[model samples]
Every structure is written in C-alpha cells, then in structure tokens.
Target: MENENKIKLFLVDDDALFLKSLEIEFMENADFTIETFATGELCIAQLSNNPDIIILDYQLDGIDQTAMNGIETLDKIKAFNPNIPVVMLSSQDKIEVAVNCMHHKAFDYVVKSETAFMRLQKIISAIFEYRKMKKELNWYMDRM
Candidate 1:
C-alpha cells in the first residue's frame, strides 16, 4: 500500500540481487513507494498505475532472450506515456548506448558502479524538486 503523497517508482531489472539492493536502498526513503518488476514487459503491463518515474535496466539478460531491451522498452513506455520520466541503468559504460537512450528521451543514463545508488538518489531527488516547482508555477499561473 502506498501513501497518497508518496512518489510512485517502478524499478525493472533482470538481476535479482541488484534489484533487491536497489529496493532496499530506496525503501529507506519514506518519500517513495517503489515497485519492482523482473521484466520490461511486466513493467509495461503496469503502466496504467502511472508511476512518477521508472528506473529500467539496459540489458535484460537472465530472462528470456525475446524480452525487450531497455531501448525497446523505453520506446513502448514513451508511446504509452511520454510524461513519465525514465532512468536507464547499465552495467556497461557504452557511450553509444547512453546517447541512444538520451535520443529516445531517457531522463538520465546511470552506469552501475559503487556510486550508482547515490547517483540514482540524487537524480530522483532532482526530479521530485523539478516536478514540485513545475506544479507550483502552474498553480500560480492558473490564478492569474
């Protein structure tokens, strides 16, 4: 169950250990209501739930080979709802892949490292702040 005020987040990854670690790290924060998915297709199925953000793994190996990769999944997500911010995560630091993700409208691309969790936290916080400011500005404009 999620509190009405908490930001909803969907994290999709095929690596169980990594997914669990991320879940644990984000769970420490009360501001987020996080949901984990083992596949991109599964995450896409839940898009109607309207998460504020999605953190998706770039490579969905260990699952079926037919499973959509991050870029394909991102395309589906954007088609479904372009407003949802998606953060693409990769263990490999490939410049081409990162650029492609950005070209496809990824909110950010984070390479998996010891500092990945910290970087993710910062990105999420910045997104929340930006959304808050946008909402506040919209409200003010509506009154004019």
Candidate 2:
C-alpha cells in the first residue's frame, strides 16, 4: 500500500535523463512521493502542492535565461516557505558554490556523482528524522 504519510519531494532539473533517473531511484523507496519539474519556474509555480522537500539542480542549462538557477530558486523557495528543506545538486564541486547554497539555507549541497543517489537517500532519511524529532519536541513543549 502506498503510504499517505510518505514525504512529498520535488525534483527539479533541466536534464531530462537525470530527472528520470532520480524519479526511478526515489520511486523504489515507498517513503517518498516524487514530483519532477524541468525548470525552477515550474517547480516554484507548484509550491502550493507543499512538498516536504526539494532537490534542485544548480545549473539549469537549455532553460530560458530568465529562469532561476538553483541558488535563485532556493532563495525564492525560502522566501515562500523557510521551513521547507531544499537540497542543492550540481555537477560543479566548487567550495564557493556549496557555501553559497548553504548561505541561502540549503539543507545540503550534493555533487552529482555515481554515489549521489545513495547520499541523497541518506540525507533524506536524516531530514525526516530531524523533522519528526522537532515535531515531537514542539508537542511536548506546548503541553509543558
């Protein structure tokens, strides 16, 4: 049975092949409900769907120049809902890029690699656990 409690995730990348691969990989896990978007704008437009997390590509090649890159999109997402966790993915492994993403409140910056999927899965699990703990703590605090 599909779990209604599964975390909803938005995967935004301009690379069709990469997006499909991610969708397939994430779909293997029952804990995630994945939604794919080809551009940051499309993803942002659907923020009303209220995904629990977002995996956004740092470089949106072939997309319109006006379209937001990962950092810009991340800023918009945070402005819209700071609580929603965003993970930035990029082929570029520059420390500066990773720092920029962190500065914009990215939950994590992942370099695209053969191990990227495994790393992302682990991060997702950690995020969920952390959120659950925070919720429980808040509940206890409210009662106290």
Candidate 3:
C-alpha cells in the first residue's frame, strides 16, 4: 500500500523491548507508517507530523527521572490537536489511572499485557470508523 493510504501510528514507550515488539507486530500485521518514540517528549515534538493514532505509555520516566508522564503528554497532545486519537498504554491496571486518562480526553486506555496489541488494533479501527460516520453525518446535515 502507498504510504499516504496507510494509517500512521506513533508508539511511545520507555521500555525498549516492548516498544520494538509492538512495532514489529504492527508492521507485520497492518499497513501502517509506524514511528517509535522512547519518550513522550519526542512524540510531542512530532505532533505536527499528524499521526492518526498514538499509543503512549503511562510511565515515561523509566529512562528520564523528570520526563512527563502519560497524562501530561496526553494533555499536550490534546492541546495541540484535540482530534488526534491517543490510546494510553500502561502496565498499571489501576482504575484511577485509566479514569484520569479518560478525564483528560484520551481516546482510550489499554493496560500493557499480552492482549495489548489486539486491543489497540480494535480501538484504532473503532476510531477510524467513528470518524468516518461523523464525517458522513456532517455531510448529510449540510445537505439539509
């Protein structure tokens, strides 16, 4: 598939192994322009590239002691472009963390586990489908 036609994804995580694994899975399974970032700061810096979806890690301080956590990154991404879908990924299974991410306008939250890749795929599909529906509805509304 052409690069323009493929979905663009930003995968942000401090864990090198997990990040590589996720990247490989997406590359093997889907037509996606995938970019991996070891830090939220790098992801934020590339917001202008306009990724269709971002899977960000909740704890980004694994390498850097003072790096912005997932919530902060989510907020920044939202501030830059509220329409970009961001899925928060974390090892933490705490409800509060997920709730906090949702409260900050995250598209969704996925706990980092064996099923994370599958869950992310589903969520990404849903995001695109929802956007398509919204656009169609707007088009119909405009005709009326």
Candidate 4:
C-alpha cells in the first residue's frame, strides 16, 4: 500500500464520469497508482509504463465511434506483453460475453455495477497471489 510499491492500475473507459468514479473508488478504498484513459488507443500508447493491471471497458465507442473496443485494446496489450493482466469491464453480464473475454485471455471479466469495485479488488488480490505462487514454483523448479 505504500507509495513506493503501490499497485499501478490502468483504467480505460470511454465514459468520463464512470472512469473518474472508478478512479476515485480505487484511490479511496485502496492504494493504487491509477492512470485513466478515455480511449483504448491512448491506453495502448502508454503500455511502456507497464501497469500492474489494466481494467478496460468493453464498449469504447462512446467517445469516439471509430475507436477500438475493449477487446481490441486487450489484444494489443497482450501482444505487447502477454504477462500483464487485463480485466474486461462491461455493463453486459451475459455468460457469452464473459466467456468471450476469457477466450481472449483476459485475466477476468467484471460487470459494471455497484459491487464492481469490490469484485475488482478481489480479482487483483487473486492475481498477485497467483503470481507469487508461480514465482515460488519457478524457484523450486530451478533448484531441482
């Protein structure tokens, strides 16, 4: 939670209000160095910063009709660095949509709702825990 090691979060959403709200929630409830982008292109451009996690909106055409959607952004992120975790966020709670996100290798899919912030928090925690386990496993394997 300390500034030196706070989680760096990238939030990509076309909705300014929602993006700001989500940013505020994370800032207040958790310790995250957050950067928000209104377009997927902007987010992709900043990939060099290496955010710890990316929460991308499913629909990104709100601000720009021609802009790439969340899935496209997710793909680009993966292409740049498949190791970075990307979480898809959308108002759609349909199972098919969730499955599609998983198919594209999203870390997780989160529905935009009152409980979204809490759900995201849990998902982020799980991601780090999994990473820790993987690192430990690799270390043991190296020893072996």
Clashing residue pairs, candidate 1? Answer: none
Candidates by lDDT, descending order = 4, 3, 1, 2
The TM-scores, one per candidate, come to 0.91, 0.92, 0.97, 0.96
RMSD of 2: 1.7
Candidate 3 per-residue lDDT over residues 2-109, each given as its tens digit: 799999999999999999999999999999999999999999999999999999999999999899998899999999999899999999999999999999999899
Pairs clashing within candidate 3: none
Query: Residue 62 of model 4: what lDDT?
Result: 98
- For candidate 1, give the lDDT of residue 70: 87
Comparing candidate 1 with candidate 4, which one achieves the higher TM-score? 4
Model 4, position 38, has a per-residue lDDT of 99
Give the per-residue Cα lDDT of candidate 1 at 98. 94
Please write out the lDDT profile of model 4 over residues 28-134, one tens digit for every residue. Answer: 99889999999999999999998999999999999889999999998999999999999999999899999999999999999999999999999999999999999
Off by over 4 Å in 2: 1-3
lDDT of predicted model 4: 0.95
> Which number leads on TM-score?
3
Worst 10 residues of 1 by lDDT: 25-34
Model 2, 5-119: lDDT tens per residue? 8889999999899999999989885568888999999999999999999999998865677777888889999999999999999999999999999999999999999999999
User: How does residue 113 of candidate 3 score in lDDT?
Assistant: 93
Regarding TM-score, does 2 or 3 come out ahead?
3
**Model 1 per-residue lDDT tens digits across residues 27-70:** 88546888999899999999999999999999986688989998
What TM-score does structure 4 among the candidates reach? 0.96
